[model samples]
Target: MALAPRHLISLSDLDDGVLDEVLELSARLKRRTGRGELAGKTIGMLFFRGSLRTRASLETAVLQLGGSVVNLTAMSDFWELEEREGSVMDGRAPEHIKDAAAVLSRYVHALAIRPAPLGNSWDVDRRDERIRAWAKYATVPVMNMESSLWHPLQALADVLTLKERLGDPRGKELAITWVHSPTPASPSAVHSLLHAALRFGMRVRLAHPAGFELDGGVLSEAEDLARASGGTLRRELSLEEAVRGARVVYARSWQSLETYGNPTLTASQRSRHIGWRIDEKLLASGQDAYLMHAMPVRRNVEVTDEVLDGPRSLLYEQAANRLPTQMALLVNLLR
Candidate 1:
């Protein structure tokens, strides 16, 4: 009998051994060693929202590895999908997700979906219903580009970038500090990075102002993983305290969980934290830390222009690594 196809919905789906293999393969592929591993494969990428880095990187990775791609944008290239179970089809959505997933499976060797949050409450979004439903119905391997709860592909590229810079990441200090943004952002990137960093035995510090805490369930699981790997996890309200003595200072903005799904409330709370921006002086407090951010960052808001363009900034490298790491993942899943 044939085995079931593998799906990468979250970092937790990969244990230590498989995770390490993926990272190692990513490094090898980065050195131009592995090529054409995805020949004769076709990948279908479905995007429910806009993207720059994620779309470009994945398409480049597939083409470079000798594979073809079919890209579709929801509500533009396809119909509005209904995910609710046992619902009447009298609403705006004309088709259900079950039909979509099943049809896509037959057309492609692997299926990848990127579903943004639907302005819903934390309790509803945290279930990650869209991607989970795809995985359940698709016969081919399913990959998560980014969802309401996790960005496993981004986490993979992050770990690969860290491995390339800092040989062995074990016991190294990594500070994931929250910065200010004019608009509310998703916490999926932060949550995935926390999981990946802790799994590699890196001591992580999460710093954010009051009322801007991350999801409690993600924190608890990350803490447990940290403990098992001899890594430590701590929370700091002050940015200075979190960045101090850290090897890597990663800055990003995320919405407050307390006011999530309420735009007006979330905006009012976020406005008060504008003073939390990262600058050179703040970054200097760390122990020669390298700066990192998943980009499309607002200059002078989230971080200063000097800091983002400085020699110590690894933002570009992080973006560049997305290609090779995704190439590695596609090869692993399809072959």
Candidate 2:
């Protein structure tokens, strides 16, 4: 009998050995050593939100691997999706995710979805109901393009970037610091990056304002993974203190979890940390640390131009690695 299809819902779904294999394969593919691994396969992507890197990279990766892609943007290509398990069909969203996932599974070898938080409470959004619903109903392999709680693909590219730059990341210190942003941002990248760094045995320092704490469950799980992988995890209220002597400094912004569901309250809390923006002086605090950020960053808000354009910045390389890492992931999932 054939085995059930594998899914890439979160970094935690991949064990150390499989994670290592994907990264190694990513490097090999980047070196022009692999092609056509995804030949004759089709991937169906449904987006509930907009994307630049995720959309471009995945589409390019599939085409480069000799596979075809079918893209669908919610509310444009189709009706708004109802994510709740059993809701009256009397609302704005016409179709249910169960029906959508099942229908797409018949047309593609794998299904991928990008669903952002619905501006609801963290308690509600953290469950990642939309993607979970799709995964539950889709017979084909499911991939998380991004979700409320995690961006596993971004985490994979980040780890691959670290491996390429640092050789072995086992003992290095990585600081994931929260920078200021006027608008609220999801904590998915932060959560996944923390998980990836910890899994690779890197000492991870998470720095953010008091109200900006990441999900407690994610933190607890990361701590456990760190202990198992010979890594150490710590939290800091001061960005400078967190980046001090670190080998890498990753700057990004996240919504105030304390004010999670309220945009006004979240904005008010974020305003208090405007000084948290990353600059050259802050970057100097690290051990000549390479700067990194998942893109679409607000210039002079989250980070200064000097640091982003600096020679030590790994931002572009991190973004570029997305293609090969995702290609490797698709190959592993489909072929």
List per-prediction Cα lDDT, in the order shown. 0.89, 0.89
lDDT of 1: 0.89
List per-candidate RMSD values in Å. Answer: 1.1, 1.2
Off by over 4 Å in 1: none
TM-score of every candidate relative to the true structure: 0.98, 0.97
- Tens digits of per-residue lDDT for model 1 on 1-335? 86788999998888888888888888888889446787888999999998999999999999999999999998789988888889998999988888888898889999989986777699889899989988988899999998877989888888988888888999999999999998656888899999999988999999999998988999999989998999989996489999988889989998888988888888888888899988999899888989998877999999999899898899999999999899988887877
lDDT for model 2, please: 0.89
Q: Which ten residues in a row have the lowest lDDT in candidate 2?
A: 31-40
TM-score of 2: 0.97
